[model samples]
Target: DKMKNKLNKQPYNTVLRREYNNLRNRITTLTRAARDDYYSEEFEINKNKPYKLWKLLNEAACRSNKKQNKEFPIEKWIDEKGKKMCTKDIANKLNNFFVNVGSELANKTQSRNPRAPTTRQRDSMFLCPITEKEVMEICKTLKINTASGIDNISASTIKNN
Candidate 1:
C-alpha cells in the first residue's frame, strides 16, 4: 500500500521514490549479509558438530518433492565368471550362494551336538531380575534424541516419570 501510494502520487515525487528505493536496497543487502554472517559464525563454532545438526534439514529435504542428490541405479552386476547379470540373475546368484553356505553351516552344527544348548538357553540360565534403580539409570543414560524403542516409550518420557 505504501509503495502503491508512493507510485500513485500526483506530483510524482522522484526524490521520495529514489530515497525509499535506496533505503530498501540497503536494507536488503544488510539483512542478507547479517544472515550470512550469523550462519558462518554458527558453523565455525560447531565445525565438529555431528549429523544431528543437519537432521531436521535432511528430514525436510526428504519430505520435499524436489530430489536433492540422486544416485545412479545399478542395472547389472559382473560375476566371477565375467557374466553381466541382470537384477533377477543377481538375486538368483545370491540365493544360491546363501543356500550353499547355509547348508554347510547347518550340516556342521547338526554334526556337533543335536542337543547343544543355544545362546538363548545360556543367557536365560544366568538371567536375574532388574532393580527399579537399574532401570531408571539405564533410561537416564539413553540419548534423548533417539526415537521410542520397540515398546513405544521414549527415553524422555521414562526420565520424566
Candidate 2:
C-alpha cells in the first residue's frame, strides 16, 4: 500500500525513493521467505504420504485434476507450408527430428581439430567388459521421471529395474 501510495504521489526525492526501495525490497524478502517456509512445511508434513504429496504438488503447480476429452491427441499445428498438421504429421516430424538428432549432436561434439579421425582408428578402439555394478551405477545416474528419448524407454524404468 505504501509503494502504491508512493507511486500515486510521484516526486523525484532521493530520500523518498530510497525509503520506497527499502520497503519494497523488505516486502519481497519477507514474502519469499514466508512462501518457502510454507512449502517446506507442507512437503515435510506430507513426506510419508505419496497421494497427499502429489495432490499438494498439483495444487501448488495450479494443475487441474480433471481429464480433458479430445478427439485428437494434440491440437493441429500450423506448418511452414501454411497447412494444419494432424497427429500423424506431427509424429512424422518428431520421428525425423529424433532420427537425425544423434548425428547432428555427434557432428557438433566432434573435436575441432582438422587432422583427426580421417580413417577408422580400429587399432585404438578397444572394448572393455562393463560389470553389473558399473551398469547399475550408470542406471542410477539416469534422471527419474523424464521424457523418453528416441528409444521410447523411460529412464525411471531402467533405473528401477
Candidate 3:
C-alpha cells in the first residue's frame, strides 16, 4: 500500500526522468551520426586524390630543416624515366623556349612601331655632343648641308673620323 502511494505521488518526477534520458540518448545518437558522416565524407574526398605533381615538385625542390640534400625529388622522377635531367637543364630548356617566344613577340612589336629602337641604339644614333666648335666643324665638312638648327656633333662620330 505504501509503495503504491509513493509511486502515485511521484509519477510526474518519473515521467520527467524518462524524458531527460530519451533526450540524452537522442543527442548521443546524433553526435555519433554526425561524426561518422564527417569521417566518411573525408574518406571519400581523399580516396581518389588529385595529384598535385607540380606542387610536389616545388616542395621536393625546397630544402627541409632536417636534411642536407638540396636536390628535389623531381630528380628521382627524371632518373626513373631514364632521362638524365638536372635543374640547370630544365632551367636552360625553359630559358631557350622563352627566348624563342620572346623573339616572335619582339617581331610583332617591331611591326607595330618600326621606328622604335632600344635606348642604347637610340642614344647612340640621335644624341649630339655638347661643343659648338665640333658642330661648326661637322657642318663645314658637310659642304652640301647648311646648318639651320644643328648645334652639336656626336663625340663618337668624331672619334671614328
Candidate with best TM-score = 2
Candidates arranged by lDDT, highest first: 2, 1, 3
Candidate 3 has an lDDT of 0.63
Off by over 4 Å in 2: 64-161
Question: Per-residue lDDT tens digits of candidate 2, residues 1-161?
Answer: 86668755977776778888888899999998998898889999989999989998997798979887756546657789887888788989989999999999998896777685466767686788999999999999999978998999999989888
Deviation of model 2 at 74, angstroms: 24
Error of 1 at 19 (Å): 0.7
Total clashes in model 3, counting residue pairs 3 or more apart in sequence or in different chains: 0
Clash total of candidate 1? 0
Q: Please provide, for model 1 over 37-80, each residue's C-alpha lDDT reduced to its tens digit, 9 standing for 90 to 100.
A: 86667666666786634643454355554667675344547867
**Alpha-carbon lDDT, every model:** 0.72, 0.86, 0.63
Q: What TM-score, over all chains together, does every model reach?
A: 0.30, 0.38, 0.23
lDDT of 2: 0.86
Better of 1 and 2 by lDDT: 2
The clash count for each model shown is 0, 0, 0
Model 2 weakest 10-residue run by lDDT: 68-77
TM-score, candidate 2, is 0.38
